[model samples]
Target: MKELAHLNKYFFKYKFYLFWGIVFTLISNLFGIVPAQVVRHALEMVKANIALYFLFENSSLQVSSYKIITFSIAVFGVLILAMAILKGIFLFAVRQTLIVMSRHIEYDLKNEIYAHYQTLPLSFYKKNSTGDLMARISEDVSKVRMYIGPSLMYLINMVILVFLVLSYMFSVNARLTWFVLIPMPILSLSIFLVSSIINKKSEKIQKSLSNLSTFVQEAFSGIRIIKSFAKEEKFVETFTKESENYRKESLSLTKVDALFSPAISFLIGLSTVICVYVGGQEIIAGKITAGNITEFIMYVFMLTWPLTALGWTSGQIQRAAASQKRINEFLKIRTDIISSENKNQDLQGKISFQNVSFTYPDTGIKALKNISFDIKEGESIAIIGSTGSGKSTIANLLFRMYDADEGKILFDDTDIKALNISNFRNQLAYVPQDVFLFSETIRNNIKFGINGVADSEIYESAKKAEIYNNIMDFEEGFDTKIGERGITLSGGQKQRISIARAIIRNPKILVLDDCLSAVDTNTENAILNNLREIMKDKTTFLISHRVSNARLADKIIVLDDGKIVEQGTHEELLATAGMYRDLYEKQSYSETVPS
Candidate 1:
């Protein structure tokens, strides 16, 4: 219940619905109690007529007695039927308000979680799995809905019905009322003992289900790799283990749920037996009539469903509390990156890394050590480094995917952190080393970021990436749908399509991080030739290992062991005989010697 306290705001948000629902529940229960009283009067009327018939035997009064009894019984029957009909009408109204309100809350809650997910930093995703996130928003939310909807509705109806029936019984005879209620405290004690066990088990069950969901998601995503390695049987064995664990947890909960109905029915049956025995004793003592005994019995039976629902509703609330606790965990996570309120700055792409230093938070490895560089607007600089030399870290800092720990990064001589994050990112386009494309058509993939883009722009961008002829060869061409993460396309095609996507943005600054690695040398040269023309007036950072690419840049910076070992024009670096000249000589020798 403490965990479920988070939903108080939603309850207040739809207070009108809650108000109407309670009103309907009260009216319906009131009408529901009327039928028992109607039955009592009808039975009493028949019993009195029987005595009158015996008294007026063999006389003309007997015929009149029969006529009166028949007409009165018929009226009582109609009255009971009317009460039942009214009760049903209000019950429908109860569902319309309370049940409908739960659905609205569910919608708002899911949207709120998804919107929060969009604001969190990349490091948060590294800490959580995709399936766990999906489970929280989908499965956990559904359990909470059950508590808000059917469980809540039944709880209100049960409470109202019990109150109305008990009040009427006490008004008629307090002694019989007390006897009928003997089993209630015992039933409550049973629920109290069982509810604690239910809360603990329900938490374990939700966690196991989350684990199962994560396993299935990863297995399906990597099915191709499994099949290629001929490890299908291994995967099947692991899946079976996860599935069996889930089934065992579920069975434990089901065993507890199975106890609720029988225990409730037995307790309610005991109440009925007590009512009959006590009412008989009272009738024999001439303290109450047979019809009064009948009325008391009906009242006991009227409380049967509500008592039964008590145990079930208790279990539901415990389960809901467990689930809501899971949801609150993610909702409580605060992102480190907060966007600036000022979004009016326009960037001219003059970038500077002023003695910047950074360390990877997850790995605790220093990726950059007092690195400093500058690039004026309209200049192309290539960052040349071997693997693990921190080439991509520069690009990440420029995009503000992360902030530098030690020094300032400036754009147009202003601190990048002070600028509006969204507005600052709008002027930059980045093509990562590992390309990712959506399961969409080529044209839509190319035009993903910017809206209202013309078809000609898509065609021109594809041509600049040197994938235009290959697309034309396909049957659907630009309309062709690429499968998940562009798996349907070859590696080179996927890379080129990503390049086309970045090109269509026409950003003021472009960072191509080894994006042309897959294509052949000829296609790479052709794309680079097109990029040189496009980058004539725009700032570009070409991050690559190949000397061929670096030799064409206006400036080249060579990195080694998390520090810049050299920085100059290709000709000047060659004159210095530093790391850059050594890399160029090795690459040149390898190319000249045949493979």
Candidate 2:
């Protein structure tokens, strides 16, 4: 219950729905006890009429047995029949209100969690797996729905039913009520023991299920690699182990859940037994009527229904509590990156990094060290580096994927940190080294981030990225579905689609982090030539290893060992006869001697 307190805001948000559900639950339970009382009165009235007739034997004023029986039947029909229908109607209403509210909350929660995921730093995503996050949103949220909706409704119904029945029993015969309630303490203790075990097992089951989900997601995502490596058997075995663990945990929970009903039923049976004995004795001693004992028995039976349901309801609560704990932990995570509270200053794309340094949080290895550079608006700068030389890291910093650990990065002389992150990011377009295109149509993929951009703009951007002709070659043109992760498209096609996606955004700065490596040199040259016109009025940073790509930039910077070692025009770097010169000579010589 404490774990579920985080839902208070949503509960209040939809309090009107909850209020009606609770009211209906109460009404249904109220009507639920009327049938038992009606049965009791019918029996008492029939007995009373028989006694009256016997006392007035041979008299014309004697009550008729047929009239008394028919009248009792009428009372039975009116009270019991009508109440049963009313109870069912209200019960249906209860479900409609509460269950609907739970769905609304679940919908809201999913959106909220997704929005939070977006706000989280890139490091958080690196630490967590996609499957684990998916589990939280899908499975964990359903568990929470159980707690808030049907479980809660039934719990309230049980309380109201128990209260009305207990009060009526005491009113009819206090001593009998006392005797019958003797089993309560034992019942409570058993529920407590079983609930504790249930809580622990439920948590394990949820965690095992998450692990299973993670395994499946990873296996599918890496299926090509697994087939190439011939490790399908290994993955299958691992999956089998995870599945076994999940089954064990679920069975453990089921075993405890199995104990609840029988334990509760056995305990409740004791109350019924006590009611019959005490009630029968009271009737025999003439302290109470037979009708009173019959009514008490019926009330005990009424109590049995909720008590039996209590077993299942308790298990549901324990499982939901476990789920709520997991959900709460995920929601409570504070994003490492917080945008500025104040409105951000306008950016003109005058980018500068003053002695910037950064290290990845998990590895603690400096990806960029004491890096300093500045690029004026509309200048095309190229970065050339070997693998792990911080070329992509520079692009990441510019996009605010991860902030620099030391010194400052600025846009238009305004500190990047002082600018609103959304606005700052909106001013930049980045095409990362690893391309990711969603399983959408080519048109939608190109027009993803930029809304209201016409098909004409999409076509123009596609042409600029040198993918328009390839798209037109497809049977469906822009409407074709690319399958999961664009698996149907070639690597070069996917990269070009990603470039087209960025080109349409029309940002103040563009960062191409090895986005053209999949394409042949000729295609890369054609795309770069088109990009030159688009980037004429925007700051462009080209991160590539190819000298052919770097030579096109107005200025080129060489990086080695996470530091900028050389910076100048490509000719100036070649004249220095250093690292850049060696790279150029190797590329140029390779080109001349190539097959």
Candidate 3:
């Protein structure tokens, strides 16, 4: 209940529907009890008419008495039928209000969670699996919905029916009513014990489901790798193991849930037996009639379904609480990267990293150590480093994907943190070392960076990336749909398409982090030539290992083991015997002796 308290606002938001639902439930139950009373009256009337018929036996009054009895019974039948019809109508209204409110709340909740996911820092994603996130939003929300809709509706209906039925039963004979209620305390104790076990098992089942979902998602996402390595059997075996575990957890829950109906039915049956026995004794003692016994039995049976549903509703509440607790865990998370609300500032592309230092939060490894560099407006600087030399970290810092743990980064002589994060990012284009494209057409992928882009702009960007000819070679040209993450395209094609996406943005600053690694030297040179013209009077940061790419930059910064070892023009770096020269000589020799 404490965990589910988060939904109070939503309940208040749709209070109108909730109010009507409760009113309708009360009216339906009121009508529902009328049929039981009608049955009791009919039985009493038959008993009285039987005596009258016997007294008028073999006389003219006997026929009149029979006719009166027939008419009276027919009238009672119509009254009972009317009560049933009215009850059904009110029941329909109850569902229309409460069920609809539950649906509305579900919609608002899902959108809220998804929007929150978008605002969370990248580190949050690193800490959580995609499947667990999906489970919380999809599976957990659905469980909560069950609590809000069917479980809640039945609970209200049961409570109202019990009050109405019990009040009438006690009015008729308090002693009989007390005898009928003897099994209630035992039933309650059973429910409390079973409910605790259900709560614990429900949480375990949900966790198992999350693990199963995570495994399936990873398997599908990496299906290509599995097939290539011929590990299909291994994957199938692993999937089976996960599935078996999920099944076992579910069965365990079902075993506990199985106790609910039988226990409720047995207690309700005991109440009915008590009613019959006590009513007979009352009749013999001249305190009640046979019709009273019949009515009491009807009341006990009337409560049977609600008592059974009580068990189910309790289980639902426990499950919803478990799921809501999971949801609250994510909703309570606060993102570390809070964006400033200043969107009016403009970028001039003069960037400086003043003694910037950073460490990867997840791994606790220092990726950058007292790194300092500067880039003037309209200048191109290439950062050359070996693997793990922290080249990509520089690009991440520039984009503000992460903030430096120490020192300051400035853009146009202003602290980067002070600028509007959205506006600052909108002015920059970044092509990461690992490219990702959606399952969209090539044209749409090129136009992804900005909305309302013209087809001519898409074609121009594609041409600049040297991918226009390859796109035209396809049957659908730019309209060809790339599969998930551009799996249908070659590695070079995917990289070129990603490059076109960045190029189409026409940003003031461009960060290409080893984007041309897959393309041939000829294509690379062609794209670089186009960039030379486009990047005129714009800041460009080319992060790569190749000296061929670095030589064209105005300045080259060589990094070794997370520290800047050298910085100079290409000719000056080649003149000196440093890490940059050693890398250049090695790459040159490797290129000459290639297979």
Could you say which candidate leads in TM-score? 3
Q: Any idea how many clashes model 1 has?
A: 0
Model 3 accuracy (lDDT, Cα): 0.91
Residue 99's lDDT in candidate 1: 99
Clash count for each candidate, listed in order shown: 0, 0, 0
Q: Which stretches of candidate 1 lie over 4 Å from their true place?
A: 54-64, 285-287
Model 3 bad stretches (over 4 Å) = 58-60, 340-343
- The residue-by-residue lDDT of candidate 1 on 1-595, one tens digit each, is 8898989999999999999999999999988888888888999899978899878988989988888998899999898899999999999999999999999999989999999998787778877898899999999999999999999999999988887888878887789889888888988998988898899999999998899899989988777789999999998899899889889988998898888889988988898899889999988988888888888878777787877888888999999999999999998998877655555588888999999999988889899999999999989999999998999999889988888899989889888888888888888988999999999999999998799999999999999999999999999999999988887888899999999999999998999999988998899989989988878878999999888888668999998877999999999999997899999999899989988
**Residues 359-381, model 3: lDDT tens digits:** 99988989999999899998999
Write one digit per residue (lDDT tens) for candidate 2, span 440-478: 899999998777898899999999999999999999999
Clashes of 3: 0
Comparing candidate 2 with candidate 3, which one achieves the higher lDDT? 3
Instruction: Assess the local accuracy of residue 477 in candidate 1 as a C-alpha lDDT between 0 and 100.
Output: 96
- Which residue pairs show collisions in model 1? none
Using all chains and alpha carbons, the TM-scores for the candidates as numbered come to 0.95, 0.96, 0.97
Model 3 alpha-carbon miss at residue 30, Å: 1.0
In order, candidate lDDTs are: 0.90, 0.87, 0.91
lDDT score, residue 507, model 1?
A: 90
Sort by TM-score, best first: what order? 3, 2, 1
